[model samples]
Target: MNKMHDFEASLQVLRGSETDITSEVNVIKTAVASANKRTAIRFQELNQKKFRMPLILGIGLLVLQQLSGINAILFYAGSIFKTAGLTNSNLAACGVGAIALLATGVTTWLLDRAGRRILLIVTSSSL
Candidate 1:
């Protein structure tokens, strides 16, 4: 028997089972090899025509999101709110955070039901 079969048999013995596990080990090895082959095929197919547009779209959306200035607004929310004449700047900032949290929760709830593209269009347009 091979080293792997010997190792499995030893493991079975340690686990208090005297039954041969060579066949089980061979089956597991076969399954692993098949999975590896499938993974290799998928990796090779990542850059194919069918995946190209969606890949580009996802990257473009990320780039646009970064360019949207939302990050800057969020980072300086307290100062911005103060500049806008809000007496309680920190409270205003907290309100902004709460609204953002609520929007995120609503978006997550709507994602599957509304679908990604429609939600993306609506949100991006609103922004």
Candidate 2:
């Protein structure tokens, strides 16, 4: 209740409120319970036989993505550039960062336009 009062105080700074904060908190609690129930239903549905393949594929792909050396390159970008005889490794690292940002922008654009299946296929194939 003290935390809820603190939260209400924070919001009151931005907006005036005459209503009881406890009532608002009760409404939020009910909404959260409904959301949790829906999520549990979805999890039960996902456990069905029809969803098994997709669940496996999704988990497998996530594991594979971690196994990929993308993180290694990003983590040791300076050392990588140095090993490749680049005098200004920092510039190379910055170039890598810029390219990663551009790729993320392009992927975000393509995901809405081209859809997930195509993007996943293209990205996984490139990997």
Estimate the TM-score of every prediction: 0.71, 0.61
lDDT of 2 by residue, 80-114 (tens): 99999999999999999999999899989988999
Candidate 1: tens digits of C-alpha lDDT, residues 39-92:
344666868999889888989888888999889999999999999998999999
Off by over 4 Å in 1: 1-6, 15-17, 30-46
* Leading candidate by lDDT: 1
Give the clash count for each candidate. Answer: 0, 0
In model 1, residue pairs whose N, Cα or C atoms come closer than 3 Å (at least 3 residues apart or on different chains), thus clashing, are none
Which number leads on TM-score?
A: 1
Off by over 4 Å in 2: 1-46, 50-54
Model 2 worst lDDT run, 10 consecutive residues: 12-21
Q: Candidate 2: how many backbone clashes? A: 0
Q: Candidate 2 lDDT (Cα, whole model)?
A: 0.83
Residue 58: error of model 1 in Å?
Answer: 0.9
